[model samples]
Target: MTEVTDFFRQGGGLSDTLPSFELRPGQIELVRAIEKSLSQHTHLVAEAGTGIGKTFSYLLPTLQHDKQVVISTATKHLQEQIFFKDLPLVEKALHKKVSACLLKGRGNYFCHYRYEMFLGSAFQLNKTQAKKVSRLQDWVQQTQSGDLSEIAAFVAEDYAFKKKITSTRENCLNSECPYFDDCFVQKVREKAKKSAVVVVNHSLLMADIVLKETGFAEILPETDVVVIDEAHHLPKIATQAFAEQVSSNQLLELGKDTLQVYRREAGDVEGFADCVEALIGAVDDLRDALADARPNGQVQLAKLKQFKRAYQAFQVLMQVFSEFLHALKALAERSSDLQKINERAEITAERIKSVFSPTAADDSHNDDTERQAAQSVAILEWHADYFKACRLPIHLGNRWQNVMQAYADSWLFVSATLSVGQSFDFFIDSLGLPADIATLQVNSPFNYAEQSVIHILPDLPAPNQHDFVPALVDAVLPILQKTKGRAFMLFTSYRNLYEAAELMQNSDFHLFIQGEHPKSQLIDAFMQSDNAVLLGTVSFWEGVDVAGEKLSCVIIDKIPFPSPGDPMIAEQSRYLESTGRSAFAHCYIPKAATLLKQGAGRLIRSNHDTGVLIFGDNRMLTKSYGRQLIEALPPARQVDSDALFTFIEDTL
Candidate 1:
């Protein structure tokens, strides 16, 4: 194996390639450990702290391992960074050619057939949608990759336009389409099969695991090593993947597509249009029923009787869906397209039926644990104007472990926030990894004592108080003034963010609210302004890096605890109670600690960077769980508000 230590030494392998690269002992150690894990075919969990150059630490070793590897990250942005920026740099530094490919979800690619059909249709669209379609047409003719990210003018705000041009698994013609020879998704798969390193997001990786036996088995190539970055997010994402989800939007889309296919293939079919209309009507009735039952737009299925009309509406919707599938089957001989649509319709109907008519294994035939594993729970969630019924597994750990064991010979889970204090038990237990898995914690080389201060406002009231936002505004105004508006006031909820935004409306400082612009645009605007304050919520907490004087302070409104009312969290809490475990300590505290660490890590991006982190929740000092949160953070000096302001003033 190539020597990781030699690569980090002075005038080493990377020195001639990367002019400004500096040697970091922690990064070198992490690379060496990962290399060993890969060579030994053992599973490893590593926590590489901030400023450790973790991306390169893993990338370099994987490139030198001389085996196929799949690197899964938490987001598409990071996937692109590794494939385009980090991988190229590593290849240049090593003076070797390494085949690599970046693959995203199918929705990210443009379907040539769908684009053609969308253009040929006589559907009416508004001015903005029409303009977007026009732009997409011009780009489609010139682009080679056919990835949606290549279109500069296209934004996700136009969902209708996106749906019209992109193809889903249920709708894609695959080998039957006229443009199948030039299909972008198939081309991507072919490239991935030939590549040594494949960069993908967590969602794709999870999809590959869940759909391994299905037609989607080729989504991921065979690999010897699997490195999952941001591994803390794996358990939740995997749970969702293994769970069954049927949504009103899904039904509506199916109806719309069925109508489109009928029009194109067999427009004269009797009663077909009426069946589609009835299916759509049933979907709307159920959505309305759910809305009336829970005005807040979410309710657990166990407590669903409170919504008198939801059950009846769900039954009616399923009946109409079956009727539509029947009608499609009757027209199967009309065209191969109709036959394909009928097959997809039947699969969707079965999925909906399974969600509504849930069953558990018989107790006499199975053990208690097996019975519990077979149970399912339904959750109704609504966002915007769409509703979904998610049927989730009661237990996901054993299933996730089985999938992991089958997927790779060696596994490396790397993240900055994987451990709680000195223990990896919280993460390992959640993901069902073996107790004996290898572990490593590499602290950042930066000196936290000289670089950062954590400010605690112990006098503030609890976050639930009615005046908490007002008090928070009062507490943060002084810091913003001291720092001259180079701060990120990250709140746990949008209500707090909006209230703070209103408070700062007339201030001299330029305010950049989260929803006012895209995240990248907001960060750019913040960096360009001398005295700007960016107020945001959850997405701003992590994966955001602004190193110099552009961002000097981070103000968190509260320790981000999972909402007690969230259906998944409540379910997990119940499961823990049944197993005789402290859910608060086992589930809630560790989750919050990881998030708090991520938020605090936004400060001190480099050894030269200095900043103040403020917590206005008061729970960080008043609650007993505060100790765990404090222990999870970097070893920055804890100080009162006055001293914190003084330090910021002196440092700037």
Candidate 2:
């Protein structure tokens, strides 16, 4: 064994220093592969199953190398695990000193400027609100770590105030602000600068690369490695970050904030009234045009685009005042007498510019740089982020791509659902990975043939059919009896979740519904309850681990495929079909296979765990694609519906 592996081994040289742990062959192979790949600067896609010890597998090699590495995960919980629990344990095991730091997005930390605004909002309140605000004030004064998530009770009571208080990227003053030295964000980055490993979430990682607003290069330019855990989430995250969004509510907030600044600075000044009037009128005109154009469910873009054209023209009026405010700030910079008024005016003008900058076309597009800048116009027509005539195009896939390229030192994209049938082509294509990347899949460690039972309910109603929910309930009733109420009833839609929860409400079984409680709390309650059935949607299908007797059965309501009418799906389908390809076979079926595998994965959480998966949807048995889906699941016993209950009882 290598020195690093020996350090991590149980009862080895560093046993007294490091946490006791084992290194399996799969994990060792993963580490060796990563070490080899990083040395050659090659890309890798490793499929490490749940029991493969993936965490230590990568960390040991990373710590051994004389390089800086950044690790990112899908959730804050996992980020904390790597930084707080896993990294410390591994470093101790190796008997080496490796600096590490944890960083989150800017909004999590307290902004002195916004906090000041929050303080004003607190005092300008009624009796009950004042008492609550006072408590918050006291807490804010004492908090060493100003994470918003720490303020548990306040989030539930004062959501609006909380939003107002959260610091935004556009509004931060950086070095010019009074709180720059005391800033939590800066402090964390400073720590990251000295550390070899920096742990962050996928969203923040994306913001650093694509948004270019997070200032990642300032710390990461010298870094040699990056690891992205939960690689499956990268594509969707990319699309969201790369895309832009503008809503009516956003414009209203901008106007309100500008109005507040105007009132506070110039005491209902002359130019302020005209600016606010034009802003409100322009927003109203767009809303009216949109309403008249589309008397439908969601606003259609075709009509909104026309409204945006007129809205852009109306936005020019604010530019006149903005220029005047700019002159005032320049004058105030020379004289201290008008500093406060000048500064406030300058801030307000910039706010207005941010609102309209995305839509307004630049006349200075002669050079290559300017042309690139002019081409990327934000389409959002409302709020501080909107332009007049364009909508911000939001692409979630691009956002994910930026993250993988940015902060991660080594990204391990692992999921039981990453492949469709026998191919990883769909997911790989979606991720936009470079050619010559290395890929590996470790077959599930479970003895699927001995432990798992897959039974597909054939000839069932369509998922959207009215009888589907009743039929699904009927199909699951016997399965639940066999397992005696220890089951996860996974659904694809809210309607189905509601129906399932209501149908099983009074069965002397604890019924938990999604959105009724915080997800973690709901899971904890379900695990603690002896006989409980949790009814949930997509998120519950994956990233859930309930081992031992707590989870004995998994009943899928139906196959989850993107709805045809969804705007993104429609656009993608049109694009693909235009290229003369079958979207159903190439796109939809493969996508369903991956999601189905994720749902089925919940059945077998550990080596000691075993359960029956009942896919209530009839398509699995009747369709040719059913074979692929069944084959994708853990190697479970194949049994007819009649024998499933007896099998569950016999296994237990």
Candidate 3:
């Protein structure tokens, strides 16, 4: 064992320093692998099961490394945990300190400039939203970092209130702003530049990649090593960052900003009011054209005739905007605000043109770099409440590697659910890592066979059947009764979640639904109440920790597969089929397996956590691929329904 592993042993530095330290062999092995990868300057994809204490495992090695390192996590919760909790523990264990800084996307930080402008702007607010704003007043003054996550009431459901207070890339004035000197984003990034280890979420990391590659000012410092904890989520985040998107919202926002700027600085510019009016009218026309369709999720742009006609009309309007923006360049010398407005207008016009073009995905950009970014095989999808045209990369592996390798020499991707059936092939192939990139799979230190029970309840309707939700709810009612409602009933879709929630409304348990409140508030309520049952969708599958008796059961309504109707998944399936690969094998099953593993993982969080994990779907017993997925998860003891009830009764 390496000295690092020895330090985690029973009488070692960590045990000597921290009273509650437990010797986890998996964590030690993970630490050794991370240390070796960092020292040798290589890449590693590791799957360390739950409760492995991976944050500390990677942090110990990263802290001791001579060169600067950046550690990115998938969630802000993990980002904050590593910076605020794990770093202190590791430093204490080693009896030495290393400087670390937490950096998040700019929107998370409070914007003094935006807040000032927001106060001056005459905005009509409802009592509810205004009450949320009032709640922020005290916390806003108390907070040092100004991260919005600290305020759970972000008005996420109310975009108008949020947009007024928060800063987005398009609206940011940067150094030109009056409050730029005391900017939270600036101060934190400057601190990160000097920090030995920088803590950031994947969104910020992806933003950094896009910024650096696009010849914009980059936020991250040059680092020798990069560790991505919760690496399973990175591929999706990267796909989004690398892809191109243009939306009605973008056009509308541009018009809004143009109108504001024109009134403030460019009133003398002729035809400005007409240009803004036309842009607004065109956006309204597009919205009205699709009013019947109300396109929500992923959709084929070509299939919608109205969408095409509206966009074609917008294309004509773009020419007018082009002329108007070009004219504004003559007035650009009037003020920096005018220059910025012109720049934003030009960029927005280009996005619309590129997205709306007949061969938008195929021959949109002339630059090789842009074309490389717009991968050869991609899905052109239209989505959302208003409208969005997006070109999503079908194969993101090679592109992800290129972006990541450009940033650092040694890279480590550590997550609890990176592997499927003891193999890292799914994850490695997804990220397009070379065959020789180091791979490791360490079992969680928790003895799942004793701590948990996995059950696929007998005789349930297939998820596709119309009666699935009711049947699933009926099957779980007894389990809920037996476990005393201290369970998380996770659903695949909001439809199913709502149906289940409706079915269980009359039950005695306190139900905490996902959308009824902020996610944090719902989880908090669930954890605090003994008879509470939290029903949630994708977000609850992972990143939830409830260690005590309050959460003694987890029930899943279906195999959490990527929806086939989802535009990205459909495109990926077609691309895989064309390449002579089974999309089910390459795309769907692996994605489902990782997600199922995450959901199942919510059950057995710590060594002391004993819970009943029930899968309401019978597919685990009948489907051909079910065994493979089952083997992929921790070795939870499979039990029949009667035995499961008995075990829960005995254990709890």
Candidate 4:
């Protein structure tokens, strides 16, 4: 507490060093809690609202602490922000040297072996792809980090070209490769091993958890403190990491790799080539079976088994895959490269078999309870593009508790929106934290009531009603006209976004659609354009910060309830129903409330910022569940259309 106070007091640590820094009470309190938690080696759940200066608050204590730390964020942008921007400022303020490194997923870095292979196989690529590879080759020589994001000409949207030059876990060859010492991924990991603080994203953290020794083991070294920023996203990411999936693309790649390895080692053995071709054909057959069966949305594999064609496809795929594995094993005796490929192929086959096979009940071990718990929540799913079997843990608290107990000595979970109705129960239960875990909530210093207004349109139809979109467009048009399009029209779905875009197509305001440009570009264009209206879906709801008059209005289409039809949501609902609980009230509503809070938060970024938050959905006013949603938001004044108009007029 004394350390925190010294840093936060006026004319203290930061104020004397940083010219524009002003100590906020909330930030100081959070930093104190973090310091105490680290000292005691306990877990802390903190809901530090926007403007709490959460990054600096957590970072200062982390740097002051004598032990190694790992700070995981939800986005690469945030990872970079912490490493490049926040860390430097904190180090400067403290006047102490702190070593920090930023590490992204391996695919982000260029692989020399893969680059050479890609160049050798240029004849297989189209002219456009060849040109892109040529440009990448030039950049590879000049780039220091070897990170693909540095190449201005390399558009990651072109997945094929990107994959051609990047190394995947299956093909990396690891220590066997000549470039192992100079490998960009290896170099990053080496840096992370030595750095006092390592910055990574949720995906990389999850990879370390799941892959253990094989993957990110080197990158995630033992650390005294582990801080998870954007902690709300952890549960979902953890569930995904632990889940199993078998896709046609994976099988296709396996077949292609086997062929390449066989050709390099055995010079195209007749029977081996035939087996590889058969394996590829089997993959195509499974895809055709899926297409013919038309699993239009995500269907449980159990349900899909009722469709004979799909069932037959599963059987055929399993048999062919087994045969392919046997062929690879036989070839493995001849070539070490083929042996490694065979081992990988065998692992994939086993995973696919496990998805098809029924789980064996075991009563001997207590650990079986956890396994059964996960199995109970698991769903085998088939979508239009891929097939997957995953566990969507409804309550992550126990799982997270176990993870922390096993791996970390001290843990801090920080997020802008972690509480509902001023209680952390919803977030706590989701993360499986015990009630006694140290909890803190710091409301944003921004004066929301003075800086923004929550304007809910009245008498509009429900989202399911046919006229909803039209009525929404009608209701928002005048507000857009009043504000002159310095607004974000956030929708829950692409359908709504497209419908709104169509209606607003003839408007004088400069319109920016989500998919029309990259998100960063769209934000840049929006900021640059006078009176620009940006129409986007879920991604725009969070991670957007546009202060001042460049953006003054945020219009949300409806309550952002998770789609009830989603496989994960449906399974969770079923699990809740079995236990005689209302999933809608407990799960759906709280999730929507959290999202709504995020959307409304976009309006007032700073104390000086003023804007109107418009919810086109009438449900916030008409629905019984609406009150809970409103309660979770910042305490902004509710205003009618006339008041909204007057407020906008006065502010702008």
TM-score of each: 0.95, 0.82, 0.90, 0.92
Clashes of each: 0, 35, 0, 2
Instruction: Report the C-alpha displacement of residue 351, candidate 4, in angstroms.
Output: 1.8
The better candidate by lDDT, 2 or 3, is: 3
Q: Which regions of candidate 4 deviate over 4 angstroms?
A: 124-130, 155-157, 213-218, 285-296, 306-312, 359-397
Model 1 per-residue lDDT tens digits across residues 301-354 = 546656679867866876788788888889978888888888888878777655
Candidate order (TM-score): 1, 4, 3, 2
**C-alpha lDDT of candidate 3 relative to the true structure:** 0.79
Q: Which is better, 1 or 2, measured by TM-score?
A: 1
Clashes of 1: 0
Candidates ranked by lDDT? 1, 4, 3, 2
> Least accurate stretch of 10 residues (summed lDDT) in model 2?
387-396
True-structure lDDT of candidate 1: 0.83
Candidate 3: where are CA atoms >4 Å away?
Answer: 123-159, 288-291, 306-333, 358-386
Which pairs clash in model 4? 397-431, 397-432
Q: Over all chains combined, what TM-score does candidate 4 have?
A: 0.92
What does candidate 3's lDDT look like per residue over 546-642, in tens digits? 8878888898888878888776677678777888999999888899888889988888777788998888778888989989878877798999877
The candidate that achieves the highest TM-score relative to the unseen native structure: 1
Candidate 2, 421: how far from true, in Å? Answer: 3.5
lDDT of candidate 4 over 1-652, digit per residue (tens): 3375578779877887678777799888898899889888998999998888898888888787666889999999899899898888888778888878889998888899887866765558778776776787688779878888887445576876677677876677888888998899998888888899999999899888666634444457778888999998887788776666666767887888787778779875678788788878876776667666775445555455656776676667677888888878878888777877988898787766455443321123346545654454545455565555544455554766766876679989999998888788777766668889889999899888888888888888888998899999988888989988899999999999999899889988899999998999999999999979999998999999998898888999998999876767777777668779889977898899888888888888887898888887888888798888888988889998788888888876
Give the local distance difference test score of model 2.
0.67
Top model number, lDDT: 1
